[model samples]
Target: MDLNVKITVLGAGAIGSLWAVALKQQQHDVQVWTRSSDSEYSVNYQDLNGNTHPLLFTANSVEHLSQSDLLLVTVKSFQVEVALAPIIKLIPNSCLIVIMHNGIGSHEAVKALFSNHCVFYATTSQAALKADAKLQHTGNGQTFIGSLFSANSSYNVLTEVFNQALSPCYWQDDIMEPLWKKLAINCAINPLTAIYQCTNGELANKNYQAQLIQVCNEVTLVMRAEGYRVKNDELYQQALTVINATADNYSSMNRDVFYQRPTEIDYITGYLIHRAKKFDIAVPVNTQLWQTIISMESSYHA
Candidate 1:
């Protein structure tokens, strides 16, 4: 609730545009940053309520070229490095940075870049899509912000700001809980959707149901072995609920494959495979799905 809190949102993608409008609605000093250029950019978005918002976001091409109280890293998972590398060394030691993106591992990378600053890993289920400068708000979901381990006073302040905005934002004392849960869900659903080029609802049919179960089972085993204490039956059921809830929606991976763009297969199922290796767990289903998506991505450029 600090008045006139300067907020710089990194990346001008779907989620980035969504947050820019949300923060702007709350009347905060806002700016958007993109690696391609270092100037103001126009962001247009349509919300879940069918409200279209268009605004010129004060933008910075270089991360270190501008200073803000809060720096939100909202770039695509794969583009994190290329976007932040030029300015990582220039980041102010006192700036608070939040890494908000799909998949895992990006947080560790960003934290390393801002080793001396206030850094946190955050995840949001709020789904949005972007094409050029246009953004479509697909679904409204909760966004949880958390530190690598525990939250502090600054966490509370940022959580309050997000809560006061349009979406429900919570501070997580143990971020690993949500992080693992999302990873498990993505492992079970994302790759298959990409390979099949189908919507979430399509996975419920007989053709894909068994495969879904197999992926979920493997993910459950890996998660339990990783010390999560999650049960296979419970995990499978939760995944089914997610599929049904987002039935008509095409997953990010699915869209990536359909559009011939690079997918985050490595971070989703690949992350599970990486963790399973540590436990010496056999995740055959996940492994196959991972390799399959990798093949799919290769076909794009070939």
Candidate 2:
């Protein structure tokens, strides 16, 4: 929680850049590691007063990332393994590795690689992006921090650190609940909105509304079969509320698909489809969405 604490942010993409700026604003010794070897990194950020601040920070390579108290991994879920491979040996055993990614399985992957170190999981509703080297914070939301299990001391310490660095740091007893909750939201809203190239509000149309409800219903059944308690109507309402709140902005999945880049479908809806197969459960709606997105990606490339 001290400003003297050295923090190294891995994967200086949109989310990572916003965090680096916020920590720097609080006077924390923060440095960002990116895939590129560029010396200067620029990010566009807006303060509480709605003033845009473009920050340019000195960039460092993986070789220069050894001197940090905490390492925040903000890479896309698919790139987590590759990004961490180069820097894992340089990280000291005392430092904590915080992973902020969508979907599941990231923590297990990191834990398997670094068996002796502390790894934490964090989820946030905060939305951000990079515009010509400027990291822009598009929307504000709360962030939850904790370990995989309950009654862990590391959860409290990490919660305090996040609270000092960002606003509304919530500590939960079971982090998986919120993680799955957010994943469910992404499963329903992301692919549908991306495929149609429409804002969240556009889902309110009668035709799209019926399709949205069906998707949520199928996902609800999958979650319940997995022994997770989630009401279909409640989750559907939450998804609709989020769509309305950020109705004007483009969902991240849409950006990826539009730019001919690989999306995180394998992590979001695909993760569920994988689990459903393991349990012999039916998830037709999710399966359809997953296949549709994959086909879209294939068509975009072809």
TM-scores vs. true structure, each candidate? 0.93, 0.94
lDDT string for model 2 (116-198, tens) is: 77777889988876766666677888898777733576447667767776788898767777888888889888899889988
Clashes within 3 Å, all models in order: 1, 5
**The best candidate in terms of lDDT:** 2
In angstroms, the error of model 1 at 144 is 1.3
Instruction: Give residue 117's error in model 1 in angstroms.
Output: 0.9
Top TM-score prediction, candidate number? 2
lDDT by residue for model 1 (1-302), tens? 36567788888877888888888888988888776564777867788888888888777744433557788888878888778887776566666788887778776676667668778778888878888888888888888888884456456888887777656998988777788888877887788888888888787788787887888888888777877888758777888888888899899889989999888877788888888899998989889988988988888877
Question: TM-score for model 1?
Answer: 0.93
Worst 10 residues of 2 by lDDT: 149-158
lDDT of each: 0.80, 0.81
